[model samples]
Target: MAFFLWLPALLLAALSEPAAASAGTSICNDTGALHQLAVTARTDGSWITQGWQALAPGDCTNPLPEGYQGRFFYFRAESPGYQFRDDSIRFCTKAGPFRAGGSGDCAARGYREQAFARARISTDSQKIPLSSRSQAAAAAPDTDAAGGTPYTAAVVLQGCSPEQEGAPAACRFVGGGMEIRATAGKQAAVPAFAFLMTLQQGAPLAVEGELISSFGSHGDLDLHSAALRQPNRHDRLLRQMQGRWVSAADPGDSFTLSGAVRQVSYRGSAMPPEFVSVLDTCHGAGTAGDFLLARDSERGTGLCYRIQSLGSDELTLIYLPRGTRLVYRRLPEG
Candidate 1:
């Protein structure tokens, strides 16, 4: 039994402390699409939440009347057909132009809770620019110091035979993320397989001998390979649990856990596991000390889960509310 929690658009705003004093915050939308935005900030010793502000492509919001205070501001934005980007902070929100008084017990207080992206507002800076560009670009391999084209991560499946062996691959930065282009013949000569390719920026050129591996008959595959660097302990533990996992006591109770750059997915028999689409942004925390924030589409409520322990072939996760421990064993790969 495989269960899945769907997380649509989970966006987060980048924060920077510039040496300038401005009246209010100016939000700019750099993506070529419309975005519905929301925000939460602390003012007058209380947290205020407001929302549904819409922005057209290449447009900036009117300098909101609120001035910058030395505190963290939260924001959320989403396109018509995409997922909402949030910072894993929970705040109250309503449908129309309305304000919520406090951030506590939103539901009990007759307000709806929604996740927000957090931005620390220093007294000096007053601008928040939002874009739809690939966040992965920051982590992308930089060009050689001599000014050569940089490399980006990519994957090509084994079964996807190229129409022309050395034909140029299409590379572009799109909404979902960076995409690598390749021409595959209509027919697959082998079982469904994939190869991770390293792409050069600006051109669709792939580095030779950059193939990662071939997965036979696997469904959708997300390949993430950064330049050769020290492996993260938590990441290594997560990778060890990627395949099908079953409960030690019950075979019928099982799930599949997969991970990517800053995200993780779990599918199993549970009722849409409380946490779906866990985004890892809290840095500096070690393997078993990191925090995972959940972004659920149906319920915009923000939830946080902490990793308790991870061992060889087994993992332990504690649900924050009740401290429920879920231990799973890795199932043998078929």
Candidate 2:
């Protein structure tokens, strides 16, 4: 997220004798999806960049020196004294300028200072390509901390089955994975941080309170977490009501709700002229009642309740079958 500005010191130059123009169809002009290429900064100054292209338009009106073979373009303000690791150097070739049409623009706009002159092909399943560099610069401070990578780590779900006994379900890394590396001053080290397997597919889960600060082989960074539980039948029913509902006409003379409702009222009619009576009880006028119907401790056909009466209090639902009235009590602060 930083930038460096330098006065223009170089201009495009024309080449006298161009290297033999590749014949028999250049790989850059393929019609299929532009294949990815691997480009490493070679110890020699031959190729210092790597990128992709489905159909490379013939050389620019003015190309670099006759042997100026650089293809993958990269730039960073932090070099020399600073260092970098876990940096991504791959980019997709596109039909238009800078592969703008693809889902991901490898180097989000405005970050280019130097451009590649040539690129080499990759040998992976994707048939990627890469460009080489002259000499490996001393590791520089990581300048691309926000870049998303295709790398993923292994994670295992644990403590959810009946045998775990009271332990909250948790997802944890079960195998070795890449570590984020960072440095400030002369101190360079890895932290203890784990990546949520869920993030690999790009599903949005927890953002805050999920990242373990400074946790991992490299400097600790916030990590993503996984979804632990799904909504149950009662939760689904409550959602259907849109947070509002009324008891049945008879209410079974003493019925209990299968799910939480926003309001509960009794309407009765009686008398010489048939007068109507309205009974308003527990819970706010437009707010959900204090408790949610839950499975009983006995785990039988009956129901129990879990109350959410006070903020930050564990819900404890109490089930009162037909013809039962339970008293509400509050204990004094100790």
Candidate 3:
């Protein structure tokens, strides 16, 4: 959701760090939306939790009062129609101005327990972005670099399970991490369907944030593996084969190809698309695969196809080497 930023009148005093040598952290609302802030921290030896720090877009606040000392702190931020999910940690909160003494049973003392996220505080007043944002986390591909129209890669990951109770370590366990071709960027975002058009033939990629992420699809292990699979050719044939495809001989069997190939099924049973890319030359079909389709980036790794027809209605790709045909028809989107 988009929010407009409103600057408070003559608000210079509130946004600045205290002139005296600082001891607490400074948080800036870079998300462009207002968020209700709550914090839990170890101050003086007692676990002190406080809240309702109204953070307007672009506004900054110390959150904690002066004389606060700690290497770390925690907070829960909520905008009117938005939720900033950081549930690996727990803290207590109450409606209206609240001051809780301990991180214990809240219901017994008229408080509600809510999950919070932790942040490392610095002795110096360093600015930290309290973000729950909607920026383009996916990098854009240049036409020259990706061999197609400019595009960006994007995916959404749902890590925090709402049914989960308390702070479970399982919530943060995202695995050894993922490998992805795309990086975070800010050029025009591409349609999810056009994701493949943005892939560079062979460009540099970095493993960032351990997001699907650290670029797996929504953090799925198989999906992330597929994202690392490079497409062999940037041809028109590749574009034509971009959506869900079902076997024309048997409708229940199908698979989808995009930035990653997935949702595959055999005899109506779900299966995995172990390798990535569908190209004209991988299978050594000298005439450019109007007759055959290759499923993997490397030859002899996946099913090879013999194309009978494309575009009109039923598209046929007869598996070569094995001589099995999987004629396909485009599945209409429901």
- lDDT tens string, model 2, 151-183? 222222211111145542232221111122211
TM per candidate? 0.35, 0.20, 0.34
Scored against the true structure, residue 177 in model 2 reaches a CA lDDT of 15
Best by lDDT: 3
lDDT of 1: 0.42
Provide the clashing-pair count of each candidate structure: 20, 51, 12
**lDDT (CA) for every model shown?**
0.42, 0.24, 0.46
Worst lDDT 10-window in candidate 3: 1-10
User: What's the lDDT for candidate 3?
Assistant: 0.46
- Please give the ranking of all candidate structures by lDDT, highest first, separated by commas: 3, 1, 2
**Candidate 1 C-alpha RMSD relative to the actual structure:** 16.5
Q: What TM-score does model 1 achieve against the real structure?
A: 0.35
Off by over 4 Å in 3: 1-24, 132-334
